[model samples]
Target: MENSAGIVKPQYVTFRDDFSFESGRVISSVTCCYETYGKLSEDKSNAVLVCHALTGSAHAAGFHRADEQKPGWWDSMIGPGKTFDTNKYFVICSNFLGSCFGTTGPSSVDPSTGKRYGIRFPVASVKDMVKLQKRLIDHLGIEKLLAVAGGSMGGMQVLEWGATYPDMMKTLIPIATTHAITPMAIAFNSIARFSITKDPRWNKGDYYEGEFPVDGLAIARMAGHITYLSDPAFNDKFGRRYSAFEGFYDFNGFFEVENYLRYNGYKFTEVFDANTYLYVLKAMDIFDLSYGRGSLSDAVELIKADTLLISVSSDFLFPPYLTEEIYDIMKYQGKKAFWYNIQSNYGHDAFLLEFEELDRLIREFFADRGL
Candidate 1:
């Protein structure tokens, strides 16, 4: 059914054939959950794929119902007359292969064992996610995409799309993402993994039948939430503020930021699975465009699509320099590329928060492309 905005609700497609993984494991079946906006043009040339970041779902815009409380994550930059202009482009967003939001993941049942895959779920890479998306796009009968865009982990998938299926898309936009996972990112992921594993209830990622490792998962989400914000952003938003109900010397209720983190953490555990978090973060930790390529330039030179790289000045996690590095490589190789550094205090999440700037850049880019 269509919402009040005339956009269809999220849909699901199950690929029942055995799917091979990069790790050499094969899954008997796979399912992809997705949402689409707009109609395919008569020439089938107006398709756009919006990849979601870590923990994001396929609901990229519009509400499922008239009274829904919130729209999709990138609602501000999509829909009629927006950055992606759903009125003109057929937009698709799918839950990643290793995600738990109605996609095949650790929580999926293993056909061989007839039980939840749990820790047995084959580990996936950014490339794996794109491959599955390619399948989904093909299933939708689109042979090529007009543009592919995303940020953070989603951006990683965008780059993978350019490299793995260089001829599949016309334009690519990667925001706040690096060609490779940095050491600092690995460190943060390690701590998050440790937090989950150390929780006694984790039981080696097999807690589906019993109590979940909610405490550890919450802590992990809290740690990740910090990296998404800049120090200045934190200072501006919280900055030594104390909770209103704090008593004399309470350890847990010391700072307002702590309370905010705790609240978010608790909320996360309610919707997310701990095993899926571990698997997806592990994938992020090992992402590298140059993994088997001779060099960074070699890998980037494989991109056939025109590229746009967007970075945030305050994004310490995937700093602006990282995006600049990719741009430098592409420029040296004489590839068509553009770079924009958004001046914002939102840090890694600036791509999501700086909607006005992003909207302007995207609109201008598409205009220049005559789309």
Candidate 2:
């Protein structure tokens, strides 16, 4: 990402001792990959933690190398004068646990067995991911954060941070996400995992020594790509277009939509691991801010930070109503809360593409608090 700040660097941190997962399981150690933008104040009071969604890495802004073609994922929202405004706040985006990125995950070596963790990796929750992030913040000696923000799966992490460690940050912004996964969402994830496991090449998540389960992962990605878009978006892009012939349904048949999904599906396999996908999806499905709590408002009571919840009008995977429920809960608790629905036809992926509105809303939110 060619931001005014130019290029950024990536780094990793490791805890070389036994770590406890939220599930009460133990891991020999843990490693986290992260990237930072801007400078941290001497008091460490200007820090902002930006959590990444599934399939996202630590590169939240700027180019990684001189020859890099793309900036970090949120380059537009996290640069000098941007919504995150790197000049004023030190921003951190870390690859969460159960990811295939530089973070220790299924692709990482198991210290006890000296092999890939794969399916043996302990199931981690959003809280677990937030705990690791808290460790990262402490590692940097940051006493408190100005804000914590993200979208989708990352949004869940944002919520986790707010409820689990509200004292750690001043504000939380979760966009296009829900406090808990709906049964419909869980069903989709289940099917995606099933596709991965059914592939013969998956080899029960032990395919590291052989050919990877590329086909299965691709199919999973393909199915996922559908939920990321709205009907209008699909119609606008590939309504009646054909990838093969103009108007013929021949033996070798295809449409622009099929080609697009197939291309994205196979392409994703190059960067993501199948097992990581399964593990992360499960974590999301099991995420419930009210788990063990009396009610949703009870979970909201734990959050001390200012909350900004943004929903997409066209998001079918995580509809606006789900996020509204959170807003309702926070309001009932008399907490400092704000909600916005971005009017778009891009579905759940709107958060990634709706930069203008996001930047405007977040900039104002930060400005009001003198962040």
Write down the TM-score of every candidate.
Answer: 0.97, 0.98
What's model 2's lDDT at 135? 91
Q: What would the per-residue lDDT of candidate 1 be over residues 1-371, giving only the tens digit for each residue?
A: 23222445879999989899888888878999999888889978899999999899998888887677878889887788778887799999999999999999999887788888999898998888998999999998888899999999999999999998999999999999998878998889888899999999999988988999999999999999999999999999999988868664865556889889999998999999999999989889888988777788888989999898999999999999999999999999898899999999999989888999999998888889887
In model 1, which regions exceed 4 Å deviation? 1-7
List RMSD in Å for every model shown.
1.7, 1.3
For candidate 2, what is the TM-score?
0.98
Instruction: Write candidate 2's Cα lDDT for 74-134 as tens digits.
Output: 8888888888888888999999988888888888999788899889999988988998999
Clashing pairs in 1: none
Please report, in order, the local distance difference test score of every candidate based on alpha carbons: 0.90, 0.90
lDDT score, residue 239, model 1?
Answer: 91
